[model samples]
Target: MDERFTIRAMKKEDIEEVYEIEKMSFTAPWSKESLYYELEQNLFAKYLVVEYEGSVIGYCGLWVIMDDAQITNIAVHPDFRGRKIGEALLRFSMQLCKEMSAKRLSLEVRVSNHIAQSLYRKLGFETGGIRKNYYTDNYEDAKVMWVNLG
Candidate 1:
């Protein structure tokens, strides 16, 4: 956290950098075209990026539908891992969702991703349920988690 970073909504010009981080962080990353569509076409989408020294280092995206928000992705560049950038990005995004009038936020994490699950729990997210075979890449079960902003 010693490094200074600014979190802001993702812009069209920031797509490439964000996509690169996405690729580095996910076993099954979203395509650049899909990311572009989320920003340009998905009305419910709210994407944010963390910038350090004028470069994108982390990003998170969510879809707020009515009073509920569902996180689609949260990731930090591989070089920036273990710095709590992911936590900061998710916290900032949750605040943004609250400002947008979202009463709750939720996300799905791989059952084996204990690190992410621990972080979510630290942020007050609780295990809600499980989605069997949620990750198409490996037929991995996903642990559903939720937090009420109120």
Candidate 2:
């Protein structure tokens, strides 16, 4: 990671920029209200933002309950793709889950998103199952992947 890049807990003020990244990266982007609820009302949710040159460039959302943690969302600004920022963010999330005593980490990715699946596999995640018609936008199937943190 470059000195100019830093990852920290997402603040309420970051919702706007983080939402922009979400819109650019996903077909069904999460609303600002949903983001707000995640930060303010969701007891199990933890969100993190990655900043570059003092600008928000990416964010990741995790939900840890008991011994399990799920990556609720993750995205990088389109302009920052291919720079390994997403990888760094995911690695940090995994460490955070471990610190929270989560024994496993999981996420669902669009089955067609080979790039993301490759990255998850590189981080030791394996395909667990598939959810048919999981995506509302195009009715795409979702590939569930998980890795044990223990």
Candidate 3:
């Protein structure tokens, strides 16, 4: 397979492209203002962008607090789906957390996102709990997943 994608630290300039994928991937996408806030003001936030031929195709965000890390969000462009781009991005995030001395990582996924859940499981994440009505858009439940990196 062609792993032509390049992953790098996200920048303020990447927001427009990231927002495009965000809207395409989520029912209720994060606002540009919110993304900007995270990139500029959120001290705990760290984001990575996946680029293909110089275009931002995927991205993931993580927050390392003390010995724990939390995945904020991850998404890929629809055109780039099924190419393992999301998986690559996630694996990269896991490494970043480890480098930051995080002992574990966790994230919440929509209960209906079986594909994502499967990927999480393949990466050694275990279902820890469920957050009821986690999605404000449709009141969908979210499954919380965790992995011990320690």
Winner by lDDT: 2
Count of backbone clashes, every candidate in sequence: 0, 0, 0
**TM-score of each predicted structure versus truth:** 0.97, 0.99, 0.97
Worst 10 residues of 3 by lDDT: 1-10
Winner by TM-score: 2
Between candidates 1 and 2, name the one with more favorable lDDT: 2
Instruction: Note the residue pairs that clash in candidate 3.
Output: none
The lDDT-based order of candidates, best leading, equals 2, 3, 1
Can you write out model 2's per-residue Cα lDDT over 1-150, one digit (the tens) per residue? 787999999999999999999999999999999999999999999999999988999999999999999999999999999999999999999999999999999999999999999999999999999999999999999999999997
Give the whole-model CA lDDT for all candidates, comma-separated.
0.93, 0.97, 0.94
Q: How close is candidate 3 to the true structure, as a TM-score?
A: 0.97
**lDDT per residue (tens digit) for residues 1-150 in model 3:** 256778999999999999999999999999999999999999999999999998999999899998999999999999989988889889999999999999999999999999999999999999999999999999999999999996
RMSD of 2: 0.5
All predictions: root-mean-square deviation over Cα?
1.0, 0.5, 1.0
